[model samples]
Structures are given as C-alpha cells and as structure tokens.
Target: MKRIILASAFLSCASLSITSTAAPMDFDFSGTFTNDNDVVLLDFSVASDSTVTIFSSSWLSPDEGNGFDPILAIWDSSGNLIEEQDDGEVVGSTESNGVTYNHGTWDSYFTQFLVAGSYQASITQYDNFAVSTSLADGFERNGNPNFTFDENFGGATQALFNGVWDDSDPRTGAWEFHILNVDTASGPGPAPAPVPAPATLALFGLGLAGLGWRNRSKKA
Candidate 1:
C-alpha cells in the first residue's frame, strides 16, 4: 500500500508539470517586396478559440524616395476579407538642424483581435497614385501584372499586388510584423483552481485516509 501511494504521488506530480508548461502562442515575420506588383502572404493556424492581435510596420527613412508606403490586409481561409489598413501611424523619424522629419506617412500599422482558426495576411505597397477605393480592387481594374521583382530576401509567399496603381506599376518595399494571443481571464482576476483528475483525486483521498488511520492507531 505504501508503494502504491508513492507511485500515485509521482504520477500526479508529472501530470501537474505537463499541464503547467504550455508553450506560448506568438510569432514574428518579416519580408521584402521586389516587384512593383509584389504581395506577401502569410498563413497561420490557431488550435483553439483565442483573441489574436496582429501588428505590422514598414521600413521608413527621411532619405528622398527611400520611404515605401505599406498596406496590410487579412482574410479568412475561405478568402473572405477580415480587415485592412492603409496607414497605421508614424513609427519613426529623423531630426536634422533643429528640424524634425516625420516619416509616419510612409510607415504602416494595424492591429486586430481574431477568433481561433486558419487565416492569411497580405502585405503590399500603398501607391501614392492609385485611384481605386481599395488596393485589391485597383489591381483588378488594371491589367494583372506579373510580380517578378526579386528583393534578394524571401519568407512569405509572393503574389501579384491586387490593386490599382495610380501609375502603371506597383511600389516595392519591406515589412515587419508579429502576432500575440492574450489570455484575458488570467490577466486580472484570480486564477481559477485547476481541476484534478479523478484518479488523482482518488489517490489523494486514499493518502489522507491512511494518515488518519495511522494517527488513530498511535492514539490507541
């Protein structure tokens, strides 16, 4: 009986350890665009229902014609549009001779809490000359051009930019982004007690009973 109790205690400890050591659900990605009509696509999957927040940024500078405007869009697995953003906010700047050069116009930013499931995100350029309402529509209105520019860097799946260009071609650029999932219940309120397995509960009860019986024996 003593050996059986010891083994049960060991098993319970192992189970607790496994339950406590869960991997974090976060990811980071970066990519560069080579062609005027280049688009970067990222695919991600969520195991269970969760609130996922996504953020995106573009490389910007004060150098003439060095800044690239970026646009971000997300879609469900079925190709339905979820959300899109043209400019998030100014992320960087440079100061020279008491002058502050704001580069916010070129940088892009976006965030959204998504439900658990498979989803895809697309990053493309925000054409200064585009006339269409949305980037995706602009590409369709114009002739679908082949995205063939090679930016010398690779990570995301590339596709033709699906939007109208004010001019005849799309702009090229680079982007950095990340995703984070939040556990709202664990953030503020008291953490709920973990439910013990039936077998573990039974073993724990037996151990208590054993101690009670031993105490009675000593008293007698």
Candidate 2:
C-alpha cells in the first residue's frame, strides 16, 4: 500500500514538474497578399497572454513608385504603443517586378515575439503608388473598393485594411495600407501559448514529488 501510494505521489509530482518546466512555444505569422490595395493601417486582436515572435511582411510596388513603407505598429488594450516596426523606419526595399504591386506581396518579412492579447497591425503607402492582392481568391468587395476584415471568418489570424483610393494624378496617386493577424496553413491549430515564467514548470514538478513522498509515508 505504501509503495503504491508513493509511486502515485511521485507520478503526480512528475506531471506537475513537466507542466511547469515547459518552454515558451515559438510563434509564426506568414501571409500572402490577399489584395492589391496599399494598406495605411491594419488592426486586429491576438489571444491576450501570448508571445508573437514572427511577423513577416512585404508589398508589391508599381515600377519606380514608393512609400508602402510598410510600418508595423502594435498597441495595447488601451491603445498604447507596445512595439513599432518601420514606423518611419525603412527596413529594406526592392524595385517593382512589373506586377504594379498595388495589392503588394510580403516577400519582405519582419519578426518579433509579442505578449498576446488585443493587438493591431497597420501597413501603409505614403506617396503615389500601387500594390497587388488576391481579391480574385473567391472573396468579393465591390462598390466599397475597400475590403474590411470579416470578423466572423477572423480570429487569431486575419487581414485588416485601412482603405483604398484611385488617384487622378499619378505622382500624388492613391495609397493603401493593411494590418493582419498571422495564421498557419493546416492541422489542429495554434500551439499552446507561451507563458512568461517557464521555470515555474520545474517548481511544479518538485512540489508534486514532495507531495507524493509525503502521501506514501502517511500510507505506510
């Protein structure tokens, strides 16, 4: 009886330790340009209490045009700046590939781990330019010209847009921007979110082991 109790207690402690010592999971965000509109600002929500590590982005550009500048900004629940990427800071740029790039492609990417929860992404085009998109990929947005995120089909991953406009003047032409939530391709879904304190898992394991030993002794 004592041995059985001790063994059970040890197993419980082991489980606790295993749970507590677990490492923070890595995160990823990969998106294809679903539209050709230059995004000025994008917004969405992340499951609060998670770390967003990878944020890859890129946009298509008309030959020789500029200013998609691709700024990535993050705000807290109260709309405070938590992190900002390319906010007036240019990471890198490549010339247009004759694709007009109005609905830009994200061959360009940014990476960062974030504390999960309500967050936002905003991409923008400051000057006259064009990008590319995959609007032809089944979804439709007519008359409005601007495609807004469908909250029903959106959750952890999504594409958010600011708006789109066509310019009469080529130089002062219209610009577009987008913000999006990172999503995965297939399978069960997002892995368990990362916790701030990974060491807690070891502590849990130790505690469980102690408890099991005590219980076993009592039974004896």
Give the winner by TM-score. Answer: 1
Which pairs of residues collide in model 1? Answer: 88-109, 90-104, 129-166, 130-166, 135-163, 136-162, 138-163, 138-164, 139-163, 139-164
Per-residue alpha-carbon lDDT of candidate 1 for residues 1-220, written as tens digits (9 for 90 to 100) = 0000100111112322221123324444444444444445554445456666555433343232332455556555565566665655546543322333344543544456666555555544543122233323323212323422232112213343322222333333444444445211010011111221221121121110000001111000
| Candidate 2: segments with Cα more than 4 A from true spot | 1-39, 48-67, 87-108, 125-220
How do the residues 1-220 of candidate 2 rate in per-residue lDDT, one tens digit apiece?
A: 0000000001112232333224332222222222323332222334434444322223344432422223344434343445544322224442221211233332223444555543333332221111112111211132222223332111202243322222111121122222223221111111112213232222211110000001111000
Q: How much does candidate 1 score in TM-score?
A: 0.45
Q: Of the candidates shown, which would achieve the greatest lDDT relative to the real structure?
A: 1
Candidate 1 backbone overlaps, count? 10
Each model's Cα RMSD: 24.3, 22.6
lDDT (C-alpha, whole model) for all candidates: 0.37, 0.26
Residues forming the 10-long window of minimal summed lDDT in candidate 2: 206-215
